[model samples]
Each structure stands twice: as structure tokens, then as C-alpha cells.
Target: MTRTLVVIGHGMTGHRLVDTVRDLDPAGHWRVVVLAEERDPAYDRVRLSAYLEGHSRTELSLVEPDFLTDPRVDLYTARPAVHVDRKTRTVRTADGDEIGYDALVLATGSRPFVPPVPGRELRNCFVQRTLDDVDALRAAVRGGQPAVVIGGGLLGIEAAHGLRLLGMQPHIVEFAPHLMPTQLDADAARVLQRGATALGLRLHCGTAVTSVDAGPDDAVRSVTLANGTVLDTDLVVFAAGIRPRDDLAVTPDLERGERGGFLVDAYCRTADEHIWAVGECAAVLGRCHGLIAPGYRMAESVARQLTDHPAEPFDGTDTSTTLKLLGVHVATFGTMPVRDSQAVEVTFAEGTTRYAKVFLQTSTGTLLGGILAGKTGSRTELTPHVGRRPPADLEQLLLPD
Candidate 1:
């Protein structure tokens, strides 16, 4: 007898879970059922900004043509799981459909966090999350119009770049003193700032948006900063941060992390033995990692367990990031030391274009973490040697060959 596996949410991580399970149990030991909230199937959200560059929805899709046609897999799109009946081991969808499961997994993912500011719900305001969001933004925007993007994080920068691509003049407003504060130090952020300015992006760092003002037509017109500076614009985009989509887990009385997300163990198992969670919704070991890499690992771990295969516990995640922002290359890896006393800091800079910094243990030569801006040719070589000591030629690791 084959057991039924019900997966809630069909985002990138959820799709990976289903694919992995099918690979492990080709004999159909566990039949898979996926409940997707979106009308369209899973797409490459990591490259979501590419949609702004004229990439069609089909181009962004992560699903293979024949993958969903598998006999053992049942996919229900635009069906969001509304309730989890823990006692009955069942899930209730918003469309009034109920499905029973021998094992259940929640991959509800996350939502963009919009700040509580007046006029935020105005017509031209948007958040970058799904294909529909980018579509809406594309339709609303007019070339050469001004746009204000709140938050200077990765998502915010990406949204700003997309706005630039749409021929809109984007002004980035960040509460932090520098750009990419989570990933880069003040000096590195300066280098990044230079690149963004060169791309015609206006940045307002160390300020918060006090309110989003609207025009007489109730459409977003301008934003007032905490520092009394007001930026007139036709669009307002919120990319501040993300919060887990764990509302459905509330009725089940599932434990949640302190920051948010359904609390789960290293195995991605919740309090209920039969139910598991992966992706942004699952707070494995009291921490919720927003990156796709950790989410994919969690999905694979859950898939292996359901297949009765040996799997390693998810102890932690690699928070390393490497990407291009506004035509500038940036990379950050390993643990960044906060104080100078903790680790030895080595930095190299070249004419406001290239900057590289590495932190090494004070007692040992072990690499703690590093930041690369402009030129990131060494990122691939240096990332792997993060916890370990690098070769004797340390200069070779810092510069491009």
C-alpha cells in the first residue's frame, strides 16, 4: 500500500521536495499531492528581476514540461491550503477541497513586509514578489517617471535595478547608513554606492520614509523622509524584508520561531510527528533562513525521511551570497566579525572600483569571512576556504588572476 504525501505551497522549495521524492521513490511508495496558491506553476524567483528584462513567464518557469505529468503526482494550482486538521491528518483548501495525507509538508514560503506608513495602499505602490507583481509594476510604470524604493537590502536593490530597466528614475531610501549593510561593511558599501550612482540611481541612506503621500487622485505622488526630505515620484515600491507565511499553521497550534515561522527540529519536523515543514515557513532549530539554498536542503532532508532513507540533520546554513547589483559585482561569505578585537581585518581597494576585505582569526590563520565588491573573480575560489586556512599566497586569493 502506497502512502499519500500532501505538500502545501508550490513555490521553488516545495517543487524541489516533490521532484526529490519522485526521484527517491520511483516505484511510487508515496503518492505526492501539491497545493499551489499561485495560478502559474513554480518559476525561478531568484531570477524574478529578469522578467523586467523582457523574459516571459514561461522563461521564468522552473517546472519541466513532463515533470508535472507524472502519474503519481497530483498538482492543484490556485488552491491555497486554508486549514490543517492535525487530528484527522488532513488539509482543507480555500476552494473547500479536503485531502488526507499520511505525511504532510508546509512550504508556504514568505511575503514582502510593507511598512506601516500612510498612503502605502495607493494605486502606484507595489511590492516585488511574484510574476503578477512585476506585471503590475510594468503596466503601471511610464518611462522617465520617478520611483522611490524603500529598503536598501538585496531585494530593494534588485527592485531598483528593475525600475531602472523600465526607464524609471529610481531613488533608494534606506534606514541603514549604507547599502547592503547586512552583507557589506561601510567601506564596501561606499564602493557599491559609487557603482549605483554611476548607473543613474539616486540613493538616500540613513533615512526612513515617514509617510507615502498621494496625489488628489489617490495615486502615489511622493514620499517624505524622516530627515524632512521629500522625493516626488510616480511609484513607491516596498522591498524592506520578508515575513513567513505561517497563518495556516496557527489553527494546528504549531510552535513558531521567536522571529516568526513554524518552529521545527533539525529534521524539519514540527511538533506533530506526521507533519513537517520546509522553506521560509519552517524555522529549523529556532532560525528561519530566507535563502533558497537552505530551503532546498530542508526540502531534500524531508524528502529523504519520507522515503525511509538516511539523511543528515540540518545543523546550520551557509549565508554566503554572490550576485550582481546595478552592474556591480558583489560577494560575501562566512562569518563577518563585528569588532576589530575579535579578528584580524585585511582590506584592499583600487581607485573606488574594486574593494576586498577578509577577516581572519586572531589566534589562528583560519578565514572568518570576507567581502568583495566590483571585481568578484576570486569569490568562487575563496568561498570554499571560508572556515579553513587559505594557501600561503594570500594575495593571490584577494586579486583576480
Candidate 2:
């Protein structure tokens, strides 16, 4: 009898797993079923900003039909796994079909977290998550009106840039003292925020939105701030954060994180050895790996271990990230939250508002983490800086001094 490998999410991780399984077992020894909750097939969600900025669905798809041609791969879209039975190793769908599986993988992924502010039921207030979200946002702001984006991290800033690309006045409201509080240091955050403001993105840091006000029926009219200031805008989209899909975890008696994510071991195995987990929905070593690269690493590890390849263990790294904002370059990586023993250094730009700063461990002179702006010519060299300990002056290595 052929073993059934059921993957519960058709995001990037599930797509990667299917491809990996095919390469491992080309023959018809295992059946693959992907339970995708969203419509429009599997897409690259990391590029959703690009999609919102005018890129079509075809440009944002990572797995085209050619990749899904394997007869073994079965796709079920818009169908959620309603229940799971670890004792009998089966997952029941919304339609009451209990799909039996030998090895189960829940990659149910995450959902956008929306706060309980007033007027949340307004038609123009949205949480950016699915292609449906981008579509709704585009239609809402079709008049090229002013837009307000809540939050200031990666998603918030990127969405702000996307709005500016769509020819709307982008306004960012952040509760934190600095933009990208998780990614950039205080000084770096100010620099990037300045870059954003120069691009006509009004910044409202160090403040929280008290409530959203809707006019007439259920349409967003203006946003009220904690400071009692009301900013008039037709649209309000929340890029706040992500919440993992853990409704089915209870069905299998699986352990979950405090913030609600499936718990998994290094091999991506859950409490039940036969069932596994990966991606942002699964917490490994207490971390919800949000970046696509780490998710791929987890998927590759599980695939190799299952095929008897016996690959070495995966060491989780500080997921550093860089991105372009309305043509401005911004990035941050490792040891960003400075400690007492870390050495902080900086370099300003020659004529433009570009600069680079690095933080290092005082004792070992090892890179702790840092950020770069204006010029990203040294971005690719970060892999070598973090991957291995190269014996050289860090500044010289970063810019040839």
C-alpha cells in the first residue's frame, strides 16, 4: 500500500515539500495532498507588496501549473481541515471527508492580526493577508486618495511604499518609538524613517491609534489617534502582525506556543512522530520562522530525513532582511538589540542620506548585527559575514575600507 503524505497548507513551504518529495521518490511510492485554504492557487506571499503595487497574479505566483503536474500531487483549495485524529491518523475536512494519511504535515500558515479598535467593521478598514486583501485595498483607494497604514515594521513600511506607488499620499502610524523596531536600531530607524518621509510618507511614530471612525453607514471616514488627533482618510489597512493557524492543533493533542503555533522538533516532527509541522505556523525552538528561507530549510531537512538521506541538523540563524522602499534601500540583520558588551560603530554618507553601521562583540570582534542604508552594494556579502567567521577587520570586509 502506498503511504499518503498530507500537507495541510499550500503556501511556499508545502510547495517546497512537494517538489522535494518528488526528487527524493520519483516513483509512485507516496501520495501528496495539499490542503490550501486560499483561492487562486499557491502564490509568493512575500511579494504581496509588489502585487499591490500593480503586479498581476501571474507575476506573483511561485508555483505554476508545470510544477504541480506530478500525478501524485493533489490540491484542494478553499477547504480547511476541520478536525484531526492522531489516534487513527486522519484529518476531517469541512465537507466531512476524513482524509487518511500515514504521515501528516500541517503548514496551515498564518493570518493577519487585527486589533479590536472601533469601526473595525467598516468597509474600508482591512487587514492585509490574502490576494483578496490587495484587491479590496486597490478598489478602495482607486480614487488616488490619502491612505493610512497602521504599524511600522516590515509589512507596514512596505505597504506604505506600495500605496505611494499607486499614487496615494501614504501615512504611517506606528506605536513604537522607531520604525522597524524589530529590525533596525534607534539611529538606523530614524534614518530609514527620514527616507520614508522624504518620499511623501507622513510618519506618526510614538503614538497609537485609539479608534477608527466610520461615517454614514459602514465606511472608514477617519482614524482617531490616542493623542486625540483625527486623520481623515478613506482607507485603513492593518499590517500589524501574523497569527498562526492552530485551530486543528487541539484535535491532534499537539503542543502549541503561547502566541498559538504548532510545536515541532528540529526534524519538523510534532508530538505525534507520524505528524510533522513547518513554516510560520509551526514554532521550532520557540521561534515562528517567518522568513521564507528558514521555512525552506525546515522543509528540506524534513524531506531528507524522511527519504533516509540522513542530512545534518539545521542551525537556526538570525534572519536578517533587506528591502527596497520607493527606490530607497533599507536593511537590518543579527544582534540588532545592542547589549553592554557590544561595540557600536557608524559611517555617514558622502552627499546623500546613505550610511552603514555595524555592531560587533567586543571580545571576539565577531559581528553581532547591523544595518545599511542609501547604498546596498554590500548587502550580498552579509551571508559570508554571518555564515562563517572570516579572519579580518569587519569594516574592511564590509567596504574594503
Candidate 3:
């Protein structure tokens, strides 16, 4: 008897699960169906900003033809899955196709959060979340137009950089006081801001767009800020924040977080034992890990258990991350954000705007977390220390007094 497996949401995490399952059981005893809401089979959402910045889609493919002439896997693109009835163990699609499954994986992923500001519905106002969203933003900025991006996170910075490449003046409006606030400490954030500015991106820190104004009836004229300053723009791109897609979590017997993410066990099992979910949609250890590595681990474990294979429960991971924006490199790892009250601490911060900061625990040498401002070159190598806090020599190492 062939075991059946159905994966909803063919984002990177979903497709990766399909491939991993096939590898774990090469005998072809598992039926894999991947339903993607996007029109094209999954490429890579992590590099979507790169595509928006002018890179070709072929550069970001995990698998060229999706299956490359293999028919064992069935992929449905632009098709949204509507209902999952655990009673019958079936998933119905928006396209009127019902798929019965022995087991299910939900990788519904996350969506860009657009705040309810006035005039957001105006033409040329866009949200950059998917390839479709990127394409629309590109189309909105035709003929060397200027664009204002809302949010200063990784996606927003990437979108702004990409927009600049297309000859669109890219400007960022951030509610936070600095760039990449969540990823980098205050000093590091300022350093990153300077790097972007050197690249010709306008940074509006501690500022937010209150309303969008349509020039005529067809395009955005400008964005009105809380400071009453209007920056003229031909297009508006919202890379604001991400919210887990949990439209299906409202049903009975399902556990969900206050912020709209599904609650899952260490094995990635939902409240319903027969069903499992991973990726951004599932919150693990009281945190929704938005990185790719964690989501992939979740998927691998869920599939293994269902097939009667050895499965490792997610013992929890030390969340550490490092990434490059335009040309600036920045990193954050492990327990860097812990309140100083719990751990011995050492710090060094300096910049004209006071850019870089590195936090370390005093007594027990742990990487804890680091913040980089002007030059984040050390972050790439030092980030791994975040998971396992290294020596307190971090202060003397990064900066010699």
C-alpha cells in the first residue's frame, strides 16, 4: 500500500518537503501532491527581492523543471486549497478538486502585512510579498519613476535596492529609529543605513507613511508622513511586516496564537494528531521562526513520522541569522536579545550617529548576540557564536580599548 502525502502551499518550504520525502523513501511508496497559490511552481521566495532588483528567475531555481520529466509528483500552481476536513482526511481545492490524503503538511507560509492607512487602495500602491507582487510593483514604476518603500526590514531594503537598479529612486520610510532594527543593534542599524545611503537610497528613520495620495486617478502622487512631510513618489511598495497565513485556523480542535499563527508540538503536529503543519504558519517553542532552516527541519520531521520512519522531535534551535543588504553584511545569533538582568554583560558602541554594538554575557562566555553598524564584515563569521556564546573576549576582540 502506497502511503499518501499532501502538501499545501508550494513555497520554498513546501517544495523542499516534497523533495526530502522522496529522497527518504526512494521506492516511490509515497504519493506527493503540492498545491501552490502562485501561478508558477515554487522558485525561491528568499530571492524574490533579488528578482525584483533585476536578477533573472532562472538564477534562483531549486529544481529547473520543478520535476524535470518526473511524473510521480503532482504540482498545482495558482490553485488555492480551501478546506481540510480531518473527519474524511481530504483537502478540497478552490479549483473544485478534492484530494484525499493519509497525511497532510501545511506550509501555507506568510503574507506581507499592509497597515490600514488611508489612500492605500490608490493605483501604483503595491505590496511586495510574492513574485506576482514584485511584478506588479515593477509595472507600477514604468518610465524611470520614483518609488517609496514602507518598512525598513530585510525585504524592504531589498525591494528598495532592486527598485534603484531599475532607475527608480528608492526611498525607505521606517517606523523604527534605525534600519534592520530587529536584526541589528542600534549601532549596526545606523551603519547599515549609511551603507544604503552611500548606495543612493534615501532613509527616513523614525518616520511612517500616514496616507497615500493619488496624483490623478491612476498613480500615486506622494506619501504623507506623520511629520507632515510629503515625499513625491510615482509608486508605493509595502514591505511592512509578515503575518502567518492562518485562514484555516478558525475551526474547532485547532490551537492558534493571538497573532494568527498555528500552535504545533515539537513534532510539528497540530491539535489534530493526524494532521501536521510546519513553516511560518506554525509557532514552535513560543516563537515563530521566520527563517528557512527551521521551517525545513519542521517539514522533514513531520514526513518521517507519518511514513513510520525515524523522526527527531524539534528540541528547539538557537535562532541565529546573518544576511547582506545591497552590499552591507549583518548578523544576529542565539540569545542576543536577552534582558541584561539575566546575564553578565559587556558592550562597546560608537559611531557619529553611534552605530555599532556587541552584547556579551560576562561570567559565562556565550555569543549571546551582536549588533553591527558601519562595517558588518565580522558578523558573518561571528554569528555562529550566537548559538553557543563564546568568551567575553568579544569586547577586546571586536574593539581594543
Candidate 4:
């Protein structure tokens, strides 16, 4: 008899697990059932902001047209798995249906965190996550008034640029001292700030929003800052961050991380041997990985183990990131801050056109990590050399060719 595998949450990592499993297990050892809360199938949530640039829904979808037609795999959209009963090895759906499973995988992903502020629920206040959220924001943007984005991280900058493209004056309000604070150092962030400003975005760094005030129509009229400054706005977009979805953690025997994700072993196995967790929902080694690359790696690892193939325990993922935001190139790899005592650093800036920094082991000259802002031409090649020594001299490596 074939085993039943129930997978919850049809996000990118979830879909990747299913695809990987199907490709490896062509013998049909396990039948798969996927439960997704969203009506649409898995799509590229990383490129979600591209929707504002005229990318269609189908273009962003990660689902293949013939994926659901496989007899071994069954996908249920808009049907969320509400309860997990380890006693019977079954999962209860929101529609009052319970499906028995031999193995369970939770890939519930994460939800946008809206800060606790007054009038946040008022009209025109939105969080950019799913296609539905972006579509609603697209329709609501009339493009004359100024829009305030509550975060200055990657998503916040993307939201600001999207709104700017819609003809609204975009203002980025960041609680941190600089933009992309987690990814780039102070000097690199400064370069990114100039690029953002040149792209027509207004920056408000080291500021916190005290409260959101609404008008008589229950729509956002203005936002007040902690420093006693008020700014008028048309809409408020909250891109603060995300919280892992661990709703099923209430079930007995299910372990959860302190920071709100399912606690799993290096093998991606939960407390119960029959259950496993992967992607943003899974916390490995006490921390949850929020990047897509790490999530993909986790999915592949779990798929290999389930298919009875040789697999290595997931140690940790490289937090290196490279992306273009608002027509500005930004890349950071290895460690963001050189915290070691014996660390050597090099910096070079070509007027207003570029700024680059590289960290090396002081004694051995091994490349540890670095940041490149403004005209990151060799980011692709340099990223792979993150933990290794550069091929050439440090001076030649930092030069903009």
C-alpha cells in the first residue's frame, strides 16, 4: 500500500518539496496531498513587487500548467489545514474534513507583521504580501498624494518604488539608523540611500511612527512620528517584517522556536518522527531562515530523506544576498559586520558612482565577507568566493573594471 503524505501551505518551499519528492520517487511510494490557504497555487513571492511593473499573475506563478494533473499528487487551494492530531496521524481541514496521513510536512511560511499602532486598520492601510494585497493596493493608489512606507528594509524599499512608479510621492520611514541595516554596513547603506534619493524616493531614517491618525471617513489622514513630527499621506504601507506561521504548534508533542516557528531537527524532523517542517516555518538551530535560497535548500534536504536517498543534515545557510532595488544595485555576502579581532578591511569609493568594501582574515588574507553598493558589476562572480580567498590582489579585486 502507498503511504499518504499530507503537506500544508503551498508556498514556494512547499511546492519545491512536492516537486522534488515526485521527481525522486517515480516509483510512487507515497501519494501527496497539498493544502493551501491561498486560492492561487504557489508563485514567486520574492518577485511579488514586480507585479507593479506590469508582470501578470501567470508570469509570477510557480505552478506548472500540468502539475496538478498528476494522479499521485492532489492539490487543494483555499483549503487550510486547521488541526493536527498526532494520535491518529491525521490533519483536520477548515471545511470539517480530516485526512489521515502517514507522514506530515508543515510549510506554512510567514505572515507580515503590522506594528501595533492606532488607526492601523483604517482604510488604505495595507501590507504587501500576496497577489491579492498588491492588487488591492494597485487599485487604491490614485497617485497624487504622498505615500508613507513604514519600513526601510528590502520589502519597504520595493514598496516605495512600486508606489513611486504609480506616480505617488514615496517616503520611506525606517526605525533603524540606515536602510538595509541588517544587510549592509553604515558606509554601504549611505551609498544605497543616495541611489534611492536619485531614484525619487524620500528617506526618513532613525525615525519611529508613534501613531496613525484617521479622518472622519475612517481613512488614514496622517501619521505622527515619535519625535513629534506629523506627515500627511494618502496611504500607509507596512513592510516591517514577517512572523513565521506556527498555528499548529498548539498540538501536543509539536515543538516550536521561541521566535515563532516550528522547531525541527537538522533533518527537518519535528518532535514526532512522522512529522517534519521546512521553509520559513521551520526553525533549524534556533533561527529561522527568511531567504528563499535557504528555504529551497531545506526543501531539497527533506525531499531526499523522504525518498530514502542519502542526505546530509542541514547545518546552516549562507545569508548572502544580492538584489537590485529601485534600479540600484546592492549585494552583501558572508558576514555583514566584521566582528573578529583579527579582521582586516579595505574600502574604496569612486566619487559618486560606486563604493565597495571587503573584509579579510588579517593573517591569511582570506576573504570573509564584504558589501558592494553603486554599480555592483561583479557581484555575481564575487558572491561565490565569499568564504574563500580572492583570486587576485585585494587592490585589484576591489577595483571597478
TM-score for predicted model 4 compared with the true structure: 0.95
Superposed model 4: Cα runs more than 4 Å off? 337-342
**What is the per-residue lDDT of model 4 for residues 57-115, given as tens digits with 9 covering 90 to 100?**
89999988678788889999999998998988889999999999999999999999999
lDDT for each residue of candidate 2 in 90-203, tens digit (9 for 90 to 100): 888888888999888888888887878888778888777889989988887754688889999888988888888888987899988988877666766766877887888998
Leading candidate by TM-score: 1
Candidate 3 lDDT, 1-401, residue by residue in tens: 78678888988888778888877777778878888888877788888877876777677677656474556688888988988888888889998888998878889999888989988888888887777788887776665666899999988898888888888888899999998776766656766777788888988889889999877565688999998989998788888989888786323446776666778889888777767788898877556777787888888887687666899987554555667776766665555555644555454655533334555556665556655544433655566566466655665545445
Local accuracy by lDDT, each model: 0.89, 0.78, 0.76, 0.86
Candidate 1 similarity to native, TM-score: 0.96
lDDT of candidate 4? 0.86
Q: Which candidate, 2 or 4, has the higher lDDT?
A: 4
Sorted by lDDT (best first), the order is 1, 4, 2, 3
Off by over 4 Å in 1: 337-342
List, in order, the clash count of every candidate structure. Answer: 0, 0, 14, 0
Q: Between candidates 1 and 2, which one is better according to TM-score?
A: 1
Angstrom error at residue 193, model 4: 1.0
Minimum summed lDDT over a 10-residue window in model 2 is located at 344-353
Q: Which candidate gets the maximum lDDT versus the true structure?
A: 1
